[model samples]
Target: MKIRCVIIDDEPFARKLLLDYCSRVPQLSVLGDFSNGLDALSFLNHNQADLIFLDIKMPGISGIDLLKTLGNRPKVIFTTAFAEYAIDGFELDAIDYLLKPFDFPRFLKAVNKAFTSFPIEKPAISLNNSPQEDFLFVKDGRDLVKVKLNDILYIKGQKDYVMFITKNRKIMSLMNMRDLEQDLIQKAFVRIHQSYIINTQHIELVASDKVRLNNEYLPVSQTYRLTFREFLEKHK
Candidate 1:
């Protein structure tokens, strides 16, 4: 089943990054996004989102607080820059915790880990075993690396080549996000900047200007921020 998802981050760049990743995956449809918890809560009462790509800290309501307020809980992946919150987030039964400034491969690992329900690892999300469009082959040196779609965090564009960042590592190749996304297992990837594609699950902070990935940041051009907000709402 396609995971209907929502994004909640105050950062504009962060929102755009997630949107770009979602565009690639066919199954991970974003339902909405929100800058604050209250706004997101209002929408959730009327709509249902399957997966939540949530940020831990915000101005009004932190992500953890919002999650606590809700009874109709969806699968949650917490994003944060501070390692101190890791324990707290996991204590809330978060599916996974992603540190900021994470590359696609690192982000992928968290998602893949989150895909497997903890304690039992039941209700697993596996691209290979699924009956739908499942796998993708990436060019790695002289060999073709077959990557399960769910295992990718984000695809980054660098000049003429693209970097396929996976859960385990990165593989650079002569490819484009446009073409690679065509076969992406889910639409959870978003292009927040011309050079960066981000996995929504790993976002640490969101602002009107740039998305904070831990200490590092990415700029959100005016051209992309507005639509990115709309994208967040859909997933929410």
Candidate 2:
């Protein structure tokens, strides 16, 4: 799945540069761009992102202060003109620190490190001979919850966890979307985008660029559009 990212830098040129750089990376998606930490923090309260490109020296709230406000923080990479904040950034367990005037190659190196550190390990499962298993158990915190495949409407991949969106509730599990896709493909689940896997049976509409699953409008990226079209044709 592409990493959803937000860029927060006080300088307009800096934000634009990061946005342009992110566009060049296939695995990175710019979800929001902000000139200050307050706006970025507000956006995070309602939306989810996988990674953040932050500036350490903002006027009101520093990048370090913003990190402190987050409860379930995403991976962060500090971008600043000063080198002194590198130690503090690392102390907060940031993925990487980039000094201002950094080149594309340097930005890419930091991103690569973030991707490498993200956990996408496959969970252990003993499947039956049947290809269509009705249910499976996933680890959620300290509990092993049994989830019925039929109950799931779609699966949204976060950085390290996949959220199982069922008819009545959402279950968060520590699992990789790619591994889950392999296991569930035989049961009629189709990956319409890097970040979304939909139960074909629940797909309400298929547009040229998006799929409608009930009330949710999930994007169908160019990478998977042709395959999704074929799936629709066969099932229709």
Question: lDDT tens digits, residues 35-125, model 2?
Answer: 9999999999898988999999998899999998998899999999999999999999999999989997678668767876766323322
Off by over 4 Å in 1: 118-236
Top candidate by lDDT: 2
- Count of residue pairs whose backbone atoms collide, per candidate: 30, 0
What TM-score, to 2 decimals, does candidate 1 have? 0.51
Stretches of candidate 2 off by over 4 Å are 120-236
Tell me the RMSD of model 2 versus the true structure.
15.3
Write one digit per residue (lDDT tens) for candidate 1, span 16-55.
7767655544446789988888899888878988778888
Model 1: worst 10 consecutive residues (lDDT sum): 118-127
